[model samples]
Target chain A: MIGEMILRNVFHRPVRTAISVIAVGVEVMLVILVVGLTSGLLHETAKRVEGVGADLMLQPPSASVFMAFSGAPMPIKIREKLEEMKYVRAVAPVLLQFNASGGLDIVYGIEQETFKAVSGGFVFHEGGELSAPNDILVDDWYAKAKQVKVGQTLRMLDNDFHVAGIVEHGKGARLFVPIQTLQELSGARDKASVFFIKLTRPEHTAAVADELRKVFPRYEIRPLKDFLSLMTSSNLPGLETFINSMIALAVSIGFLVIFLSMYTIIIERTREIGVLKSLGASKGFIVRALLSETAVICGIGIVLGIGMTFGMRAVLTRVFPTLTILVTVDWVLRATLIAVVGGLVGASYPAWLASRKDPIEALSYE
Target chain B: MQNAATILAPAIEGFLPGEWDVDLILKTDNLWKVYRSGKLEVSALRGVNFEVLPGEFVAVMGPSGCGKSSLLYVIGGLAQATRGHVLVDGNDMMALSDAARTKLRRHKVGFVFQRFNLLPTLDAYGNIAIAQHIHGNGFDPHRFEVVTSMLKLTDRLHHKPSELSGGEQQRVAIARAIINEPKILLADEPTGNLDTKNSEIVLGMLRQLNRDLGQTIVMITHNPEAAAYAGRVVHMRDGVIVDGVPED
Candidate 1:
């Protein structure tokens, strides 16, 4: 009976109820989108790094393990010394550059023969692989987003290059060019950003890393697994804070909207509360009723939020193909839990106030 | 003074003593209620002793500001007396905690207000069933049928309060107050908002319920016609009982 009463009361003022529901839905949507995008970026980064098919990685002493932001370039001669060591099957040097389009595109420069030797060769979706110094290979997603086709001219870093081919999704950088040409364009000739070293046997990974560490004492030599772990860890500055702030903002918006809505409801129903008390309703009963109403609203909001998330993902994938959004069950559950908790917390004060009203005064209220 | 047969039978009384026998279901001894706002004190009830025996239909009559409503609220355990003793169903209200007092009200007392305070969102049946729900027992279909039939609300059960007439609404309120089978029914001007015809209808229903079910009732009203339905009427003036004097 109490539950039915609460449900009816929630619909007593339809406009106000709709507004509150929408507020919660919008907040839940924002939380899922922001968190989902971040997770997708991390997942894609890990996959791309693992696709290199290397057992060990070598970087300059001062360079960060995160390839996207690492700026310190190593001497290209380091690849020859690593290839000569025991248990080293092959070595490929890679030059990394941020494109002139506001750093949205990562440009990787690779020597065709050594890159194919150390890592598996790329699978082209449109045309043949890179053959000329000015030829570039783009990923499918980037190609769709940039609207560039094979045999078309593309511009990056204020230089024109011919589009040679389109790589399979999640294979490599969005834009790829010849190593010597990129080195000249970046003004760091014979300097590579990192080296990918393939081991002869799977068991030699740790020993090979130890050997390379001694060979280049001042450099950072790590097994591929440790390097990937470092890339995914919280070593990225401001990322943790950014995610935390997004969560906080989402919670605050949900909490305040529910608080204001429930508070206004209490004020409007002061007389009704008195009537309930007169009918022998305990304070606990009133609080439970109010909370149950809020939970119902939040439940609806969460469902709507999840629906909107899938809808937005579908639309985003079609419009901006390069953007990835990962909506896993765990993330959905987390968003629901946060929204419900925020709504309950917001309603607590109003429930308390309604429960504490004097029955006589409330009865007499106009 | 009239004997029990004259008073408890169908005879009318202008005044009665404030004391009763040990069979009392409700009693208040020297109950005092003081309202303070910024150092100004207003005493609503001043040393008022009252009692109602089991199955008695008693009426408390007073002018405005004579503490009739305050005394009813205190006896119903809805408000705390400033300094006094209130006993309902043989339990001392002052000795009980706030929560216990609430429990006492939930299980032992039912209230009907002058305004017919039915929940606007609920229909007549829902309003009546809520009292039983609050008492922790799901609705008793048998008792619901009995109460609705007795109050003549069988046909109007599904109508909301706004859709019902004033008298029908009050009947629903009466049905709600009695559905839980509380030990006592405390009504504050149950017919205060009705016309003469509806007032007579409601008063007749109250009288029939008392006579048929042996229900104990304490009603506060200013209209003598409303008080006439009770077996005895106690009149108050200036926060003190003026018409009723108990025999030692």
Candidate 2:
């Protein structure tokens, strides 16, 4: 009966209830979207790094392990030294650059034969692999997004390059061109961004990385798996803090909205609370009623938030085909828990205030 | 009848140890209440002694601000007396903790307000059921139906308070007050907000419940006509009892 009263009370004032639900819903949506987007980015980065199929990555000591933002250049001489090592079978030097369009597109300059030897050969969706000096291979999603077809000329760094083929999704960077041509165009004659090293024996990866690290003390050399772990484990500067800040922002929004709404409700229902007290309602009863009402509202808002997340994800994917959004069950549960807890915390103060009101004074209140 | 163990066990075990005067179900010795605001003080009740026997219907009559309502509130354990003793069912209310007093109120006393005090969100049935819920006795469907039928609210149980007429709302309030079968029902101007016809209807229902069920009632009203339903009337003036005789 008390539960029914609580339900009715929530719906009794439709406008107030709607505002509270929408406010909580929007906060939950932001939590899921922001956290989900961050997770998607990490997942995609790891998959691409693994797809390179290299035993180790060697970069300048100051370069970031994150492939997309890695900018410090290493001497191309390092690739030759790595190939001369006993266990190293092949070494590919890559020049990485962020596109002018907000760094969403990654350009990789690679030697065709050495790249294919260090990493598995790409699977082309259309046309053949890299053959001409100005030929470039782009990922299928990026090709479609940028409308780059085979035989079409695409410009990068003030130079025109012919689209040679479209690689399968997640195969490589969004754009790939000849290393020498890119080096000349970018005015870096003997510099490469990073070196991908392949080992003859898979079990020798750790030993090879340790040896390379000692040989080039000014460079960073790590097994591919280790680098991926570092990226996902939040060891990258500002990533964990950024995600934590987003979560805090989302929870704050939910907390303030529920607090204000429930506070106003308690004020408006002062007489009703007095009546309940007069009818022998214990303080526990009043608190339970208020919290139950808040829980139901938060539950509804969470459901709406989850629905909105998937709907927004569908729309975003259609608009930006290359954008990946992973809505995992874990994230959904986390968002739901956050919203409910925020709501309960928000309503707690108001519930306590209502319970502590003097019955006679409240009853006489106009 | 409705599992006495569930309804009476807590009340019996937690009841305060005091002088057990079986005949006097409610008593107040020199009950005093003073209102304080900043540096000013106004006394609402002054050295008033009162008593109500079991199964008695007593009406307290007074003009506005005569402490009639304050006496009811103190006796009902809803307010504290400045320097006095209030005994309900032989337990000293002033000596009990707030939670214990709340429990005693739930198990022994019920209140009906002048405003009819029905939760607007709940229908008539829900409002009545909630009383039993708060009393910690759980719901007894048969007793609920019996009370609703006695109050002539059987057909109107599905309607919310807003949808009910003033008389019907007061009747529902009355049913809620007694749904737990409390030993005493404290009503403060229950018909103050009703029209003449509705006031008569509500007063009649109170009289019927008192007579048929042997329910102890203490009602506060200014109208002598409303007092006629009670077995005794106590008149008050300037926070003190002016007349102690019961009109036959």
Model 1 lDDT per residue over B1-248, tens place: 33222112121122212323346677788989998999999999999888787788889999999999999998988889998788776576776777777888888888888999999999998999999999888989999999999999999999999999999999999999999898899999999999999999998998888899988999999999999999889999878777754443
Worst lDDT 10-window in candidate 1 chain B = B6-15
lDDT for position A81 in model 2 = 86
Clashing pairs in 1: none
Worst 10 residues of 2 chain B by lDDT: B1-10
Fnat (0 to 1) per candidate: 0.77, 0.87
The estimated TM-scores of all candidates read 0.93, 0.94
lDDT of 2 by residue, A1-366 (tens): 888899999999999998889878887888888877877877777678777888888888877777657665878987778888989999999988766843367788999999899888888899888888899998988877777799898877778889999898764577899998888877778889888888999899988878887899878787887755676627567878988898899899899999999999999999999998888788998999999999999998998889989999999888787787878898899999999999999999999999999999888878
Model 1 agreement with the true structure over A87-119: per-residue lDDT tens digits: 889898999998867337778899888888877
Reference-based lDDT, each prediction: 0.85, 0.86
The runs of at least 3 residues in candidate 2 whose Cα sits more than 4 Å from the true structure, single-residue gaps closed, are: A131-133, B1-12, B245-248
> Which candidate number would show the highest lDDT if scored against the true structure?
2
Instruction: State each candidate's clash count.
Output: 0, 0
Cα distance off (Å), candidate 1, residue B85: 1.6
